[model samples]
Target: MAKKGDMLYAWTNDAEIKKHAELGGAVTGLWKFALESKAVDAVLVITKGTDLYDAQPVLISDPKELAKTAGSLHCGTLLMPKLIKNYFDGAANMKIGVTVKGCDAMAFYELAKRKQINLDNIIMIGVNCGGSVSPVRARKMITEKFGVDPDTVHKEEIDKGQFIIEYEGGHKGISMDELEEAGYGRRTNCRRCKMKVPRQADLACGNWGVIGDKAGKATFVEVCSEKGANLLEGAVKKGIIATEPANPKGLEIRGKVEGAMLKLGEKWRKKDFEGLGEGKDRLKKIMTETSRCIKCYSCILACPICYCVDCTTKNPAYVKPGELPPSFMFHLIRYAHIADSCVNCGQCEELCPAEIPNALFMHAQQVELEKMFGHVPGVNMELPLMAYVEEKQERARLKNTGSDMIYENVFNPVLKN
Candidate 1:
């Protein structure tokens, strides 16, 4: 993960990159950094695609480059990890700087542990997330509600009080009161996502007071790791990100949902591993659910990992030309092959037309694997179960007692205990 002249660059958003790096300040309580800080040689800012909320990752080695690309924008987690990997792979020997949302950082962590990329030399910057919307859905919502083409709407903005939709004709603002009463605006993923502390990050940054408080104008930033702390100390010494601990009000603004996610994560974390359906019966359940799969292979394309040269589904092996649903065996075999390594990211479920909870099935399979083989798939930095040579005892663990295969491995009349 390290090499000569490598600088890990990261960004919170376009506004953060330009305003903070250029003025020697920090944005939204993110750590402040002076362009002169040697601890961070460069910065990479991500920007919202022109006319789109989805931001494409951008790398900046020079302060000038940082200023140019940074500006007002939104961050979308869906494409962030893919963008990070794309940039990291191209950098190769040189260390790169980058920023990621909570889920993106988790995905990166999972990938890094698997040795997909060496991230030790990379700098990680993290941002607190409120989640984001799909462009298609957002546009459709605006068009239906506001009676205007969403793309023609001059601007759309979100603030503590309301969601403001500004059009060429006029602007309409939806108050937080209304949004709450109407049960609108928040993304579904946020309801399920539990990571809030940025506990896995090096630095956590944000603008705590500025959103609702006009008088005070400091960003709320916390150093979550030694590397982040050292960088912040350097910035503070140089008067770049100068501040004291923020008021406790920001936490209140985050309110019940953040607390709910934290509670859910804690609750799930404490559950006994044995309670996760990690038995042969559990494995059978997974196989049964997968049997409903119609060889759609949509899951393969949805997966970030199944990056094969040519998938078997497309080859002459199983699929015939113009087949209706391919074959059920294709999906069943794929589940068996990839379930051990699956991270349960839920992409397959998200993309499934049948609304099958493929991720849940994979999660159950992973639980079974963890119980029997002592493997947890993508989370561990150590080698995967499939990577290891199976000991005689280990192989015997899979066979049912009284079965022929079990008898072959375990039975000896002279040695029976």
Candidate 2:
């Protein structure tokens, strides 16, 4: 059996699956094996919808139906964990195998910690995500920048710092930096996100480490958990897939690639948050940005962490209904509730009609909470920072806290003269 941390080069033996899959159909083959072997009751995956730009999440119970979910959709910005939580009752009734991007895996981890989903009943297949583009924006970019019909585009990929598109007769490529400079690249949240590999998941699989003769023909699979190892071993033993030890050089290159992506993300984080400034300047900026909120509640609705049945934003005591430009209390309540658990998933900002940089703000707070408590959200099953504080006095103070307490107690402690 494969052990945790074992890296292997693997590919599907099914020619049809290989032809349609992004990288040798290893994920597809694994899902097929899981279903046929009755290892999972269903497979949750994203599939191309009406057009290549429109991607939808699907739950497949039959192995034969896995083909429709093959291929990668970089334009798919949907988070699958929320779907499982809200629609499927956290998959409590079934065993599931699901594909996850870094954000999805993180969100799932947070959900599991809250007992919303039973992690033991699920298999998570992690995909290495460079980033994702907003579909509507991507379509416009393809038509205007690439001089191609967005509807006719066959495939899109980000590699070697370029956004490449394949069409009927030819292919075109443009540097992502150039595109972003022209206001057309990955979503701002994705650009700043450092989590490229879903290391928290069962198996992390991608094309990053498959090189030399196996380049583009096999997937680099990192077994992150015993569950992942078992799935891979079972697939190989069942003759559904083939595997070989990954090349050491290829593994090194993969690490370098991830490092570069993380470095780029750090640069983005600095660029995006630098304008917030410090002290009153930062407070003023946040207040100014949030003042534009029409209280549409889109951010709260789209948030994976905000699962409270009686949300504070909806409570009249905190925020009056039909209030335009909702009270700052609404925003404050949300930040306090979700900052420790925010996974920087970008859904809130994406769904916000006011275009508030919700992810950036929440992530900034999450970073602070992390440093203060050494609790990194979504990387593991660890409880949130507030969970460990057992002092009743401190809890009472926290319950009665206001915005000033953050600067006084958290950000800048008052020193006695």
Q: What is each predicted model's overall lDDT from 0 to 1?
A: 0.52, 0.86
Error of 2 at 270 (Å): 1.0
Give the number of the best model, judged by lDDT. Answer: 2
The per-prediction tally of clashing pairs is 18, 0
- Report the lDDT tens digits of candidate 1 across residue range 315-383: 544556556555555666566656666654556765666666676665556556767878654333566
Runs in model 1 with CA error above 4 Å?
1-44, 68-77, 84-87, 90-92, 154-164, 169-188, 207-216, 249-257, 261-302, 305-324, 333-417
TM-score (C-alpha, index-matched) for candidate 1: 0.63
Count clashing pairs, candidate 2: 0
